[model samples]
Target chain A: MSECCGTTATIEAPVEPRVAGRIRTVALVGPPNSGKSTLFNRLTGLRQKVANYPGVTVEQRVGRLNGIGRGDLTLIDLPGIYGLDSYSEDARVAVDVLHGEMPGTPAPDAILLVLDSLQLRRQLMLAAPVLNLGLPTLVLLNMSDLMEARGGRVDTLALAQELGVPVAKISATRGAGLDAITHFLNRKAEAEKPVPAEGRIELPVMGNPRSYRQWATGISTRTKYKAPLSNEWTKRIDGVLLHRIWGPLIFLVVVFAVFQVVFSIGQPLSDAFGEVLNAGGGRIGALLGHGWVESLLIDGVWRGVASVLVFLPQILLLFLFIGVLEDSGYLARAALIADRVMRSIGLNGKAFIPLLSAYACAVPAIMATRTIENKRDRFATILVAPFMTCSARLPIYMLMIAAFIPNTPLLGDFFGLRAAVMLSLYVLGFVAALGTAWLLKSSILKASSAPFILELPQYRLPTVRSLSLRLVDRGKVFLRQAGTVILAVTIVLWILSHIPFHADLAGSVIGRLGQLVEPVIKPLGFNWKIGIGLLTSVLAREVIVGTLGTLYGADPATQSLGLQAALRHDLTLGGAMALVVFFAFAMQCTSTIAIVRRETNSWRWPAVQFAYMSVLAYVAALATNQAILHFVH
Target chain B: MVAIALLSDFGVEEADELDLSGAWKLRQLSELPIGTVGVVESLDLPGEIQHHLMHMGFMPEARVMVVRRAPAGDPTVYSIDGFEVALRRDTAGAIRVREYEGQNTRQG
Candidate 1:
């Protein structure tokens, strides 16, 4: 809908010629670990959200400027990157947009070059090339909150004068520094001004064409930090955190513990929701008097969407863990540890941020890959990004692992064992990703691995405001997406299963369809119950369980629960394993398919991804059930 | 053993007159070739070289350059691809090479 408001620049390679405007747009740029997003959040509020540019899966966040007193300004947050010389998809998009190469993407009237207060000199290296463009630039001194806490301060005015730019000191978290930015924005004169050729600095100092030292000196002079080199406390923390071994170990333990807690805490709430929905459905069905009205009340809409909604607790849990890790500054360290194995020669070490994000959701992760400068690495990374198991897959994994893996306690059996199964599924996704990468590197994507050239930013306490706003933005997208496409698919599936089967016809056409498919599914030990479950799952994989609940007499009292006992009573072991295999390979979620289409800019990849996944699901299910029947039966 | 240590972002042309032997430890340059590095052997082209040098990270402090030149030198490539770039033969002449270690025969 925002597209209707204006012709926005495509995030892929924005070459938006500046259209005539009473006001100019300003975009902030900085290195990947530069806290650019944190500052952007500070500037934009919850109005900022992520979207992919048409045809490219690149994630870009743009928000209307409200704080600068001029709601007329639009503040675009280009992906966080280390330099203009891109090595990944994110940096490439930033380069394209910075140059206004991406069509429909407007070049900023001016650039707000944000340098991390702790990592000023290095952050300026990224701002250097942008300054060369000669736009009226403002250098934002972010992370001032940390400076005070760490026993230091920066000389903002001196730094600004030295850089020949206005410098504002603000903690995007605490909401300081808006006055300086607003004063700059209110001036109409600076917006229309053209940058001199000297100010339009050319790409500098690769073969030593003289501009490198000049850029470095420009930053050195413009940037002043009151802290003595290597603050003692920071060094002490880094001694353990940046340690060769213990740091990574601590990080893994922390992440693993998060998953355990999520499963334990969220399971009961899931049950409550399931029970309430069923009770409501029963009341509605009884009041409607048992015809199409009864079917509609109990089966059609409620059952369809309910199945996927059951996964909400799981989805919310996943998002919470991700939010905490990112907000805690631990994710950055995770990236650092993963870097040695992940990054190769010829690529900047900074590309780690996006790759780590893939685990949460590939949509943003793929967009994040834009930070890499090398075309070869960028292209290769994009091509293989989908293989990383995103959080959406969590629901399907939880169901399959629960249904298939027996839950007798281990480790003196104190805690539930479902958590361990969940961890293994995560491990499987990771192994699958690595194997796929190895294959691509050897075959289609023969691009040599680039080395890690990166600036490991000093860690700081994350702001609650920024993290909460980000979580809100992400949560909104999940809900909106579910309410639309997932909602529709759930409706059609509900209809399909309600038509007619036996005398009373409590089950529908979908039930009949499942009966028809049972011959083929029998090898997987599926009865019509399993058949109906499979058909409904195609709407959204987790719907398989919810649909079964409705058909087998869902008691509103038993909502949001693992129907493991029920399924065990009704189906064989082979059938459960078959269901797991089916989900693992089926292209079940319509939302994901839609995202795939949006990301690839073509229907081809989504179609292919779906077909391959579906066929694999069927084959894996058949084999698992057939093998289990051959022995266990 | 002596060598010419010239810091350049983009590597030079294959045929050049300078000493490019022994190891070079690359520090940083702005814009170098995407995934390769080379040894610089001369000082020339102050204009074109500067743009690529700063972009690739051929900093004054680092040593990185061509480890070896291949037989047929059209897509002439350097071996080291890193933050501190190593320019190949074509790029080396543009950089003012110095001797940090061992310098070999200067074949023009």
Candidate 2:
């Protein structure tokens, strides 16, 4: 488990306070969507990934404040919350880090409060509680550009005098006024000792939030600041986007376009990359000349990396769309539109973002569930996320539909029989996910209903530079996974497949394992070869096509026909459909299970996830094969 | 014109408490028409819900406007302090508000 998941009990002495060899810790705290993450990114510069939206920063993200105090000042970017009170999990995390109660985090030497300057009065309600903490603190009035655009200005000096803290006006999105923040941190870091004026600060009028708001309003009057006019264009756009009749229709069209991009754009790029890798591997094999080194280089390392690298296009495109949607603030409106339908299935609107992302890949989708506040809602969302047909299942689906179903048009050139089967599979995946959540929520995970409160932030254009940086970071993560776990698994499976070097694969260790499991899967119309493909595919779903290719002794270069033609010669139509149905529900990826364990912080949930998915796959495949064979064969 | 006519029909009842002038009519926020602005009278809800609402800037005497409703018209969006917050109608029912007359004239 990562440091973020460590228990709250373990507390080592304050590490950063000693300052002899360690860096100073300064926590950046703010309310939801106040540009705290954007400021963190600007201060840390391309070294950190900006956590966008509310509750997205579930774990602690510490970044180095470059060029400040021996370049060793660590800036901890915390989850955006309303205040210090423990009303939600994200709020609790902020409180823990502020008080140094969480394991592996030391008491902060300073607190930097990032507030949206345009919404100063509303945001200052949060400012009062944090100011009462009384550590060495500085206030950052962010979004000065928007404030100016709305014909308003902030009296930074007057506000600073009233609050007894240094205040700087900055635009985190445009990278303005960051040097003032650096100077503030440097000045605070060089102080002789940590300020101990804990009880010196008076309560803002009184202790409760009502008094805090009153105090905040009073302080606003001293700054000679006028409330900026709210963005009328956002509400205008919402009139159409959040319309009673058109909102849901537009949402469906947007979702359809995303999937179309994922398939139409991602498929060719994957094929092109696969071809380049195969050509390079083939040349290396010829040079090494028919030995274990040749086999290991061509079949083990190259193939493993190739399998994982193929999903790069889909991952990049998925994050790109997600960035645009979230940065534009349309995701909140979509969640609101989806809330009505989702509530019928026992989930709140907040689960919609994670659930939608699951269509591209389940790993990131599962991670995105951190934004959901309710524990039961988050768990239910995670457990059913894998049931969505991810990009990994595309290869298996395409191979099956192409090899089994004819290319006859169903409704014009637009909708072919093959396309119909693909669409049905996606719909089936969503239906199954919804059904599982409904069952789980009503049965074992039932609890008192939690109220849903989602803030719909104003829309803004997504900058090209930030979007490209996010795209690159997501691509890097996917490639890194391909380099490590996926690479290792391929090598291990390669060794198992090639043991007893003198004999054929029919007599190898993997061959024996396949034969052993053949009878168990035979009821689902899978023979020994299919059994072997299923076993190797547990490493990744796409590996089944490659495994079937190697098992049939076909050339890997002509990927279009080698596997498809071989499968056509080997399997019946009923069996092909059964395989596709099985792949849809099977928990095939080891990385997904690993992520589940880490996210849930338990081995039991992943185990339960694996068991339930496998059983569901087996039963569905059996029924599918039996019905198809009885009617057609 | 229809919304204005509907607003003018609200009946105000006199209160025996200290300073209520019998000029404001109290109503559940969920009962207000879309786009109507109201001043929060009080949040008669469970302690946790009330605390969370206050923390989110839905304080007593704060002006809130009913922005829009979901497709099913159950969870409605309310604009408070320039932020749009969407919550279920059942949750909104716990909030008591009086129609805003230019500004909040009643003092605590």
DockQ of each: 0.06, 0.42
In angstroms, give how far residue A311 of model 2 lies from its true place.
0.8
lDDT of 2 at B82: 68
Quick one: best DockQ, which candidate?
A: 2
Q: Look at candidate 1 and tell me the lDDT of residue A218.
A: 50
Q: Positional deviation of A172 in candidate 1, in angstroms?
A: 2.8
Q: TM-score: which candidate is best?
A: 2
Question: What total of clashing residue pairs does each candidate reach?
Answer: 115, 0
**lDDT of each residue in A380-476, candidate 1, tens digit only:** 4554455455554666567656766777777667655777756655665555555645665666557543333322234456556665675576556
Tens-digit per-residue lDDT, A402-453, candidate 2: 8889989999999999999999899888888988999889987785656888
lDDT of each: 0.57, 0.77
CAPRI-style grade of the A/B interface in model 1: incorrect
